[model samples]
Target: MGNRQSVVREAARFAEWVLREVGRELRVARLIAGMTQGQVAGVLGTSISHVSRVEHGLIKGAGLVALSRHAAVVGLKPWIKLYPIVGRPLDRAQLALFAKFRDRIAGTWRVTLEAPMPIPGDLRAADALLAMPGCQCMVEIITRLADFQAQVRMAHRKQRDIGASRLILVVAGNDTNRRAVRDAGAAVRDAFPLDTRATLAALTSGVDPGADGLVLL
Candidate 1:
């Protein structure tokens, strides 16, 4: 009985912390980009209330379609994807692969994470990501990689500087699951000059304690 009480208390504390952290990130990003709440809300096709809920972590559940849209307004490159775990144990390959770009995305970056498998009830992947050392704007991109590709392509076609400032994708996968990602990088590079020199070789299996994949800018 005592343990149960502790667990409940811990869960409540975690929820509160997540809400406060997300609020801080949203506020900071909105300010940094010199964009207003109304403007951000417009981009999201939502009212101030919905955006407020998201920033406050009041959101409880999301579908693939909804997540894709929300991530877009948050101004991160959004994808819809499911992935089985890949890479070496501890599954830090992707982080290592993306290491060279870490510093840029660490603080200002926003992210959308997805789990291919049925996620545990207790694990809020999005919030956990926000808690990562340098993660900011972390949201979950739910569905298939193809969906995510389409989202990015649309953002690229519709927006002036799509994905230039965001660390768009973060799923649990490895080299096998990264082909589409590589192609997307190529497509983005073709359209504009980004820091494309970094390659997968530079990364090692490690965690990016601090990073954000999706962003306002």
Candidate 2:
């Protein structure tokens, strides 16, 4: 219910932004065509106040027909474009690195890719989940690290919500990612106490790491 309400609110905000931009464009078109609001109202068979309201994006609720007419009078065409929501695209290098990591641990741990969060109605999912006798780990794989703090917070949330015994961030061993981890320094170390070597050893041995970890892939 909360997620649905948030989506509705976001949609409303985006609609409001689009309406305001369209209104501005319409006003600009009228000015470019050397026409007055009264002239536009006359052409559209509407009142000057209605035209003014539309131009200001103050009119609301089922006004598409009126808006279309107004747009035509102002010598503007209105259309809609749709796009799919998608995650960040990984490059070939990242894909190859991820595959190698998967193969390395495939023999020891039970790995689930794109593991859904345990909470019902939650759309978010972990990059991977690894399980064995003593530990259940929620893992996030980052080929390119941006906004380190935000990523840490998101990982923490997933770990808590999924009730995993440990959280592991598998970062690509590129210079950029390495520098980012180095710059983060103590914060990274504190959040993920176990080092890459320790984390890998634990996973290979099917033992509990006993804490959160950051592994360089």
Give the top-scoring candidate (lDDT): 2
Stretches of candidate 1 off by over 4 Å are 56-71, 76-217
lDDT for residue 163 in candidate 2, whole number 0-100: 79
Q: Mind giving the per-residue lDDT tens digits that candidate 2 earns over 1-217?
A: 8876877776676667667777888999999999999999888777889777777777755267767877888788788644211122345765676676776564778887767767643546777788987678998888889978888988888788777889988899889999999999999988999988888887776778898988897
TM-score of each: 0.30, 0.57
Task: Please identify model 2 stretches exceeding 4 Å from their true place.
Answer: 1-94
Instruction: Output the number of the TM-score-best candidate.
Output: 2
TM-score of model 2 vs. true structure: 0.57
Candidate 2 lDDT? 0.78
Alpha-carbon local distance difference test for all models? 0.42, 0.78
What TM-score number comes out for model 1? 0.30
